[model samples]
Target: MLGEMHDVLHEFPDLKDKINELHDNDAEFAKLMDTHDQLDDKIRGLEEHEQPVSDFHMEDLKKQRALLKDQIYDILRGLS
Candidate 1:
């Protein structure tokens, strides 16, 4: 979990420091944490499936990813 989280933070360096700071530190973290956790789990599940998925399914995942990213951004903005 920590390794994957590190890779995610490294991939998006802008959020790297902020995420480190939020590693169980903030009181307002619960709501944002839920969205983050759910998205991460869904992404992992989709990626780990043995069979290949259709383009349509890929598109759906992308949309969900975008929504999750937006939610994360909104939470960060609110904190700021």
Candidate 2:
């Protein structure tokens, strides 16, 4: 489970419609999601491939991903 995918849609299945609508119409939301996905990819790659990186760096990336998820959730909540 080290490299598990944390896809936004998967994370918030109930908000799928809202997420897609925002992704299509809101550039900022799309960008944030894109960055989150990129971070997830990086983290997954590091863990899956056993890439060498400091623990602090890995923790920092995870923190950033969590922050992005929270921001996305806040946006979804406002709309939902």
Candidate 3:
């Protein structure tokens, strides 16, 4: 199992209420957050266990996750 958790709620505990509001009310935000969490899970699983994916693919996944995080952060930061 992965040793670390990088979920949105974990990353921004202070913005718990805001995150919940957006997650429940904003369809786009919810979709992006869902995607981010899925990517996190995939990346962590790949890291802990061997997989057939190439180094490049793994890096690409990480990059995608980072972008999603930035987008989510921007939204949260604007309100907070």
Candidate 4:
């Protein structure tokens, strides 16, 4: 999944640039970044669990996913 994420950014360097461009001042981007960090931490925490039932982590992931979708939509809108 991380590889896929990297591929998306690599495949669309312009979009990545757009994101980086907005990182400094955009509240959405800041929130997205924070969500991404939380998702990463939660995922890492769950990784070592033998039988993890991570409903709360799943919710965090869902929120991050929605934020990502919004960010992508905003980027596409910018392109248009």
User: By TM-score, highest first, what's the ranking?
Assistant: 2, 3, 1, 4
Query: What does candidate 4's lDDT look like per residue over 1-80, in tens digits?
Result: 42134222443476676666666677766666556555555554555453465689666665765566566556546842
Backbone steric clashes in candidate 1, count: 0
The local lDDT score (0 to 100) that residue 37 gets in candidate 1 is 62
Better of 3 and 4 by TM-score: 3
Which of the numbered candidates is closest to the native, going by highest lDDT? 2
lDDT of each: 0.58, 0.92, 0.88, 0.56
Residue 3 of model 2, lDDT score: 87
What's the CA error at residue 2 for candidate 4, in Å? 9.0
Determine which window of 10 residues in candidate 4 has minimal summed lDDT. Answer: 2-11
Tell how far residue 62 is off in model 3, in angstroms. Answer: 0.5
Q: Total clashing residue pairs per candidate?
A: 0, 0, 0, 0
RMSD for each model, in Å, please?
5.1, 1.6, 2.4, 4.5
Model 1 spans with C-alpha error above 4 angstroms = 1-11, 26-51
lDDT (tens digit, per residue) of candidate 2 on 1-80: 89899979878998999999999999999999899988999999999999999999999999999999999999899942
Model 3 pairs whose backbones collide: none
Candidate 1 TM-score over all chains jointly: 0.52
Model 1: worst 10 consecutive residues (lDDT sum) = 1-10
> Alpha carbon lDDT of residue 74, candidate 2?
91
User: 6-47 in candidate 3: lDDT tens per residue?
Assistant: 888988899999999999999999999999999998988887
lDDT of 1 by residue, 1-80 (tens): 31143123443578767766765687555455556566666656666653477879856865775665665666656744
